[model samples]
Target: MKMAGIETLSWEPLFVMRLDVAYDRAHPVGGENRRGIFPVVGGTFEGPKMRGRVLDGGADWVSWRGDGTMLIDVRTALETDDGALISMQYTGLSTPTSPEAAARFARREPSPYEDLYLHTTPRFETAHAKYEWLNRVIAVSNGMRTDDGPMYHVFAIT
Candidate 1:
């Protein structure tokens, strides 16, 4: 069997979820790993197929790695305006370009998205009959950090 070339793949805009989350705190874990929790307060999402609001109570389970790069792990619940529920999860990395940049990022200070390569691959699940397509496809996400929280634009791989 022959593998398909990369040029055959394409991305379709899934939805943009501007998640509003706040850092709970950070602490040393297992003597070497740094862990933190960021609560998902609230926000909204929109795209060509579905639109919804992100609910609160969901949390981002964060791990600080040795190379000064942050590993993002988040679980989110979305309530579509039409009353459907969608589960969202994403994992990615935020690696700063320099030590100063890393410091600024750690302190929750203003930093550029270009300076810190922040990206995530998002996966989605939903039971709604109309939006069931989400559960079948894979999604790729990319976004930046806002003063309020982290924002993401997810695209489905087609």
Candidate 2:
């Protein structure tokens, strides 16, 4: 299932695991913009299949499908002092021209896979939140973002 402008690829096995995130109010201080890395551990035991686990807190769990999509839902539970459950989903695309590109992610350490034309729908719980305009990029993933205005290259790298 490809989303028009974004490129999709077949099943490429990547590491999958359920992690217990310690709660700290200032933990995600920088939010998404803050770049950080973590070591993921899980091999043949949970390899190339649907893997899932329930987190300690309620309404929290994570599952990782072999495909390339990572399903993450971390809402509401964060208000507590404990922590939130994490789930991952991977959806493998069959149309990628390069098979090796998919294989590269199946390893102990995987290189970054770029994703272009990624559309994100904001989830605002309260009515007080104000919506803003979408940021326009010249290009991503070696292709253009908006076809109307100017040409911007965006590639579905990840």
Candidate 3:
């Protein structure tokens, strides 16, 4: 018997987004996790297709699990250079490469991107005709934590 082959997926560079985040203390929610809220105060993004500033008033609701993994749900908006507003949301998983790294992160210390696994799936919505294409693309991002916030290299699935 012969097996069918699978096609490899490809990606195209979309943008690089650096979010200036404000952290809030995490408090125990209950049985197995702690919850925290992080505000997206401001930032900037640039790419081949677009460039803009990240609007204020967005936030990330984070859950720190007992198993040392962080689950993040973020909702933010972007204002293009030309003034088009786009809403963006993403869900992501963040895991430290080691127990020490996890401790450092908990203490709000910065870590190299290689010291953690941080990945996100982002969905974009826009009413601007110039950016309508974003509404239909499947996007993914790899991110790293910084002292000021987090920066992500976003890509579009092809």
Candidate 4:
């Protein structure tokens, strides 16, 4: 079963790969935790074929093409299965400045519909964008300002 838009990027008989990939780079970011991990996932979806990639579990980057609409955003986030926090931020398109604005693009429901964005307590010490509650799973699609900009939703899962 798929949770959030983050379905099993790679489905294996007994082990389905979720968006919880980590990198070798690990450090501290301005007194915050730096796990060098990005919880991003990609899969075929309904219309635009949404593809997501995390920058650090905090930012999500997505790309998809529809009838006459092309999407690209890199401002998305996700939590880890082990309760680690990661965040993503884009250098190009201006990301949401406020939590309200950021949330405007945030997923309202889970991916594939029924699956809800799971939440858990972060084990690492880090400062995320704004949202108080982190999501275990997330989906990217068309929306107001969110779906309008380039797919720069960067993500960083555990």
Best by TM-score: 3
Off by over 4 Å in 3: 1-5, 24-32
lDDT ranking, best first: 3, 1, 4, 2
lDDT of 1 by residue, 15-51 (tens): 8888787655433353365787778888999999889
| 136: Cα error in model 4, Å | 22
Look at candidate 2 and tell me the lDDT of residue 40.
25
TM-score of each predicted structure versus truth: 0.86, 0.22, 0.90, 0.19
lDDT of 3 at 151: 88
- lDDT by residue for model 3 (49-157), tens: 9999999899888887778889989999999999999999999999999988888887878789887899999999999999999999999999887877798999999
Per-model clash counts, in order, read: 0, 37, 0, 41
lDDT values for all models: 0.81, 0.25, 0.89, 0.28
Q: Which candidate comes out best when scored by lDDT? A: 3
Query: Which window of 10 residues has the lowest lDDT sum in candidate 4?
Result: 43-52
Model 1 Cα displacement at 92 (Å)? 1.5
Candidate 4: Cα lDDT at 131:
31
Q: For residue 3, what is the lDDT in candidate 4? A: 75
* Angstrom error at residue 29, model 4: 34
